[model samples]
Target: MKVYISADMEGVTGLVDAEDVQPPGRDYERGRGMMTEDVNAATRGAFAAGAAAVLVNDAHGPMRNLLPDLLDPRALLIKGRPKPMGMIEGLDSSYDAVLCVGFHARAGVLGVLSHSFMGHEIEDIWLDDQVTGEIGLFEATASAYGVPVVLLTGDDTACAEAVAWNSSIRTVPVKYAKDRFAAQLVPVAEARSAIEAGAREALRSLPSAVGAGARTLSVRWQSASVVSHLTAIPGVARRDDRTVTVTADMPQLYRLFNLFLRVATAVTSNPPYC
Candidate 1:
């Protein structure tokens, strides 16, 4: 079986702030190593579960956070930006399962470094009027391709979020949140072991397929200017001064969400979580 892993930084082990996930800082540099180690753990678990191939996507801010040299040689890595599917890039029907590593809660939540796709720029997002975040969006999109999200690793809140979204998926929590920027973290070695074990068990007995279909996506931006810019795209409609809604099926809706991020990037210079 082929396994796909999407790696993000915010929910990585021992990370609790922007200084740890953002670039050009000593902490961020160290965090990258930690992120790579976590991905390696998950990859190792996938292989142990009898997976023949594994693909790991660097799904964080710049999408280049994972160190290629340090990554597990047995797994292929997808790095860099401008990807059509963003977090779920390279996901397709060929993969048997997906593993979301180091993901956090959505914006307005209390998970460590919590925010939606674009830090403070994206206030909220809804898929068919159900509040959604990166985790939910990725799972929904993956389902469209007939792939099951078997394993997820993150903080306790992130793990809980995953269970709430789909009860059957297995989760390993690396930390327990005390606040948005603070958490009681598990030791690095212990966290990785749990992640490895979780991945192994999750893949051992995969969940039944949960089908997908067309849905509407509504995004609320922190700035009206960002919303105004997005309306220029076809099928995007203004919902309010700071919100816009678009309807499309899996991959199309997923692509349009990325386009909205591009527009938001062009219009706003506000720092994330501001």
Candidate 2:
């Protein structure tokens, strides 16, 4: 079976700051190492469950945090920015399972870093009238294609959110959150074991279920400026001052997401400072 792993950073076992996920910062390299080890743990678990192929997508910015040379030789790694699928890049229905590693709660979750896509620019994102963060929206999009998420890992808030989105899936929480940015963590070694075990269990009995079709997505921003910014896309329309709406079917969501993310990143972004 083929498996896809979408990996994020803020919810990684010890990650606590924005600087930690970006390169050249004092803590980024260490954070990236921690993220990779978590991915490796999941990858190993998938292998144990008889997966024939695995693909790891670096869902974080810059998208090059995972060291290609060190990733398990059994899987292919897609890294870097500007991919057509963005966070859900490199995914399709043919893949049997997906694992979301290190995702966190939506932008408003207390203490979590960059709670919104753009910390100061976006307020909330929604789908099916339900508020969602990267985790729910992405997973729901995957479900549109009949790809059920088999496993997920993150801090307590994230795992709880995942359960609400799709309770059938298994989750491994690496830390208990004091708030979004503050967390009491389980050591890396202990966290790694939980993630690996969960992945294996999830995939060992992968379900055969069809997806619920075509989804409409709404992104609520901090202000009208942000909404105006996203409406530049042809399919995107201003639903309100703080919201923009987009419509997409199974295949279309992936294509649209790439464009949506591009507009979002470009408009709300200020170049990084040292």
Off by over 4 Å in 1: none
Give candidate 2 regions above 4 Å deviation. Answer: 270-274
Candidate 1 per-residue lDDT over residues 10-43, each given as its tens digit: 8999999888999875699999999999999999
Q: What are the clashing pairs of model 2? A: 107-115, 107-116, 110-180, 111-180, 111-181, 112-180, 112-181
TM-scores for candidates 1 onward, in order: 0.98, 0.93
Residues 145-202 of candidate 2: C-alpha lDDT, one tens digit per residue: 7888988898888888888988887999888888645778899899999999999999
Q: Which candidate gets the maximum lDDT versus the true structure? A: 1
lDDT, residue 263, model 2: 72
**lDDT score, residue 233, model 1?**
91
